[model samples]
Target: DAGITQSPRHKVTETGTPVTLRCHQTENHRYMYWYRQDPGHGLRLIHYSYGVKDTDKGEVSDGYSVSRSKTEDFLLTLESATSSQTSVYFCAISLRVFDTEAFFGQGTRLTVV
Candidate 1:
């Protein structure tokens, strides 16, 4: 286990609303990532922060954003929720090699109506 947790294990929201998901870690890992897992598309990265104040967009970052001002916390926000964004979200942390296996939080199931 990588000592990671995600809040609101499940969420339901209307379209056009704003939502934020939180990721917390206890190991003080240097890398944290937010990814969305869809049925056929697999797990796609939304954003990642390598360190405090050091963040970058990932492959599927268009409708999402992230921030990390501390080593143990990373936040993901959906500016405006959309039905297209309904998916299971997962947070991961990396502490070993670059391709090191990541540990995932239980996941947050988001549904936008």
Candidate 2:
């Protein structure tokens, strides 16, 4: 089972506004990630945290930021919402840091208008 949960299953925000999405995990995994799923891009990584306060940018990290204050929680923030940022965001947890296995949350759908 996916032990990860994403808050605010759906959201509609205006462009230029700051938006934050939350991912909570109960699996106590050491690695957590934020990914955006688009029609053609599939799932593109936005950011990932290996531990508390330890985060690194991913392929599409521009205009985005992430924070991990606790092992159970990871947050992704869009500094300024943009039409291009509208997509389904997913949270993933892994038992291994190198992508051995991952469990994904239901996903949060965000629309920028």
Clashes of each: 0, 0
lDDT of 2 by residue, 10-78 (tens): 999999999999999998898999999999898999999998999999999999999999999999999
* Location of the lowest summed lDDT over 10 successive residues in candidate 2: 94-103
Instruction: Specify the highest-TM-score model's number.
Output: 2
Judging by lDDT against the true structure, name the best candidate. 2
Task: Estimate the lDDT of model 2.
Answer: 0.94
Write the residue-wise lDDT of candidate 1 on 1-113 in tens digits.
77999998999999999999999999878889999999899999999988999999999999898889899999999999999999999999988536778888999999999
- CA lDDT of each prediction against the hidden true structure: 0.93, 0.94
Q: Which regions in candidate 1 have their CA more than 4 angstroms from the true location?
A: 97-99
lDDT, model 2, position 43: 95
Name the TM-score of candidate 1: 0.95
TM-score of each model, in listed order: 0.95, 0.96
